[model samples]
Target chain A: MPYPKVDVDEWRLSVKGCVEEPLHLTYNDLLRLPQITQSVTLECAGNKRALRDPKTRGEQFLLGAISNAVWTGVPLQTILYLAGIRPEAQEIVFQGMDVGFRTDIPDLLSYSRSLPVTKAIHPDTLLALFMNYEPLPAKHGFPVRLVVPGWYAMGSVKWLRRILVIEHPFDGPYQSRDYVLYTRPDDYAHGVPITEIQVNSSIAYPTDQQTVRRGNQYVYGIAWSGSNNVTEIDISTDGGHIWQPADWIDSEQRYTWRRWSFHWKADLPGEYMIMSRASDESGAVQRQQALWNVKGYVNNSIHQVKVYVE
Target chain B: MPYPKVDVDEWRLSVKGCVEEPLHLTYNDLLRLPQITQSVTLECAGNKRALRDPKTRGEQFLLGAISNAVWTGVPLQTILYLAGIRPEAQEIVFQGMDVGFRTDIPDLLSYSRSLPVTKAIHPDTLLALFMNYEPLPAKHGFPVRLVVPGWYAMGSVKWLRRILVIEHPFDGPYQSRDYVLYTRPDDYAHGVPITEIQVNSSIAYPTDQQTVRRGNQYVYGIAWSGSNNVTEIDISTDGGHIWQPADWIDSEQRYTWRRWSFHWKADLPGEYMIMSRASDESGAVQRQQALWNVKGYVNNSIHQVKVYVE
Candidate 1:
């Protein structure tokens, strides 16, 4: 979908519902508050959707949908504290200005997703004003947007306009009808909502199907896990037959990707498949194949690239 | 491999061997000569190497290895005419300064390739000095490079230094061994050298595994062929089970890619494997699968992208 053009001056972020003090804040009003900057990696839940077998329904995203950026914004908890959340509030719903009609639904709906009150009040969640040191681009979310670190990017709602403190469990389309993993169409009641990202790694150099002369070469890539830091990365040069530890190129950090590299002596001439596997501090290792879901979400499979040596 | 640094002032292009008048021209001398610009598409011979079944030997390039640009250069025929080729000259050999030692060979070898004298003297063959209105970048080839239009990019030798008119066939590694298609280990002698590009097409948008909501959408991509213009492009939304002609978005042109689009009314929700098949003026159509070879060269198969409609 195209980005919605929002007039920054006319835009007002409304915080209502079960809040003790309903508030409408202009862009400048939020900017005047104490701010913090953080480097965070955001990945689409549907990344690597193309690799899913039997094919699932949804936007088929490849590995390129994940990225890291430094964001400057007010803590979401700061706003919630100012508005004073009611004791009965059960969830916080974030709604974006972008809306569309669904083929299966009769009414037009805005893109919205709700988070548990605990997560919404976390200090890490932010009402982001700047990304990579610049005011948010319209495509990302201009004026203001929600940044839910460690979780999939869908929870970081863009073009945000309203925040409602609800007294009951929220069941919006994005929260209940989609983003939830359903094994069978009739199993909607048992569907699980996607949350934390799984441990994952991808090969960036010696791209798939590249031909190289036999000799010394460096194989490198990036790895990330939700909430936890990547502790190790293993490289397999012989089609996963054997694996060797890769050296970390960057220091361990929270909510950001870690770079790793392995020096490979491609001494023989022939075809080989190189794969990277990552493990998080939580002892979570990337799987060979991700469990299949109807929406093809949370694919954290080991990444592989095929190369030929002559 | 990193680009070879050629000091323009110290560099001299030598035309020798079977030439009637051996000549050495400086960078400034070549710059003083008349030049012409032409838009041409250059595709690596190993493009789509990953798509080859049973796997092939070489760099596994995807569909991105092909590109079009306006190249500025002096006609190679003009320089060959100045040097005056001998009547006994059977082939013209072009050599680049980049050299490296191979594990199988004891001596360091420079990259080189040869073309028949007829193709060498063709008016379209060029000694390119600029690409897309800018001087050749070091990564591309600094100072000068050979641009063989209508042929696989392997023929366009980069970091050019020597031009030799030979009385016999050239048996350089690039010319007779690497770029040749070998069906079996013992088929080296009968391996065919890759030449003109085959008719081909690729979907640029609505990438593989992309999910889209049911509605009106445009499926667009590019198509190209060697020498001949693309005559038609057919899009199949049902995994090649059906084919519909696509409308041309760009005027038909020789030696460059043509853009085509199809307006699709996606009324239903399901899985789709969108495919594009292109036919050229020569009546050549993209095949379902390209003929397999050890080097994986000249693959011009129809392109397919899987998408989900929600």
Candidate 2:
């Protein structure tokens, strides 16, 4: 599939359904609103598909689908309030301008998502028009896009076009069926939406399969939680028996990954599985293995790299 | 500064204050209650003091302040129910058998914590009597201990002695003064109790400063978000420009650290900074720097390590 080509001049954002006053606004109208800027991170639901199987299926995202950027936009809450949301509205569906066929659905439909009304009205939710201070890129979502803070990239519907308020749970294929966790033995019947990103950490140096001479060295890596701050990172040179603390550098910026450094004295001449672990404020711990699921969503496990020392 | 020794035969856990029926129970009485086993992770508020400044001014913790084990205990809710908590009770204070003096307090006071009634009566809250299938050890908590799941280790007051149901927010030095986040510039006035363990991650292999030969290498680590699940881990071998995904090696287990691995092919001979980033279900992200506070609590930033390639 190719990225959608949208005519900015012809594009219009429409807010309809379950509102006393529906909205039909052009790009200029959105620009007229007082702009707010925020640095938000978006991660594809399948960022680690390879964790499920070395050979991935459907979409194989090898870390390219995740990024953080400063976004400029109008608060979605302002528009929701101006439209006069009906008290009866239970859901708010955002539809992207990009249309495509899906194997999960019987008919062609625009990429869309139905968010709980409460989530739709959150102050952080935005109808973003810019990425990194520039007009939203075509591939990213030009004209307008929904920037859902603290949620997976799927929640941030790019190339957004329609905002529909409805009275029932959105049972679209992505909502009720596709983007869910089948990690439970019962399968999809008891699955949950892959909403928030999980806590995870990884090593970036000594490129995998890189050999190192026996002497003093160091290991560098980054770690982040979806919305909460990372408290600590531990590094182990001896498989899993012992762990050493790593020091974080710089400021703890919200919605962004933090950097940490550890002094490693690689004194042995053998293959070593250098590992790192991360823990968040909410008490969630990374596992040694990915939770196997039908959809393979939210597979945050411990990160390890095998390195040789000679 | 040593663990208090208590004769289990004579120790009595008293349930008084704001209860319809004040009761006194001994060690044997607690064992009679239906036992439930749970695996919970406990972390000290100062788990990563070395991450701040190597020479810590206050209590220092390296990676050893955290552990997870199976606990056998009776639900705190059951005892609360039997005691008939008065509607006016707003706080539930767990007082440990150990008593000591603190700089903030005028007189000796038992190491204690005040929990909200709601949290005190949570189904998972327990008055644990055994750990890892064995009777609680003296250093860990002898006769009985309050085990508050999903909270920092301080909330699990050891060597339990008394349970006080009070009608107001407990204002003991530990509650209103110590354990609060002094990271804010203004200091203690706006501080918050260090309740839950902050999100954190660590590397377990390639002992710090260890030397490595140039060739193929693997990086490993573990991650956790207090009570939530980890979602993603990104690795960057070339500073921060490009990131590669690390594969989780095992199944996702609750209340435990996860393991992940990355494949690196180091073709050059030079120093490299390997890093990792993690995200959690609660949407918390690791920061680039620790959130500075007077007490330095909840500093979950990204982790990195330095290594030489020759």
lDDT of each: 0.88, 0.77
Give one digit per residue, the lDDT tens place, for model 1 in B1-310: 6779988999999999998799899999899999989989999988887667666666656678998988999999999999999899999999998898754566989989999999889888999999999999997888899999899899999999999999999998788777887877657778888889889999987887676778888998999999898899999999898999999998887889999999888878887889999999999999899887777788888899887777
Error of 1 at B72 (Å): 3.4
Top of the candidates by DockQ: 1
Interface RMSD, per-candidate values to 1 decimal: 4.4, 22.2
Task: Write model 1 residue lDDT over A34-74, tens digit each, in one string.
Answer: 99999999999988775566666667565688999999999
State which candidate has the highest TM-score: 1
Q: Quote model 1's iRMS.
A: 4.4
Instruction: Report the CAPRI category for model 1.
Output: acceptable
Residue B183, candidate 2: C-alpha displacement in angstroms: 58
Each model's TM-score, in the order given?
0.85, 0.49
DockQ of all candidates, in order?
0.33, 0.01
Model 2 agreement with the true structure over B49-73: per-residue lDDT tens digits:
6456422234545456778788899
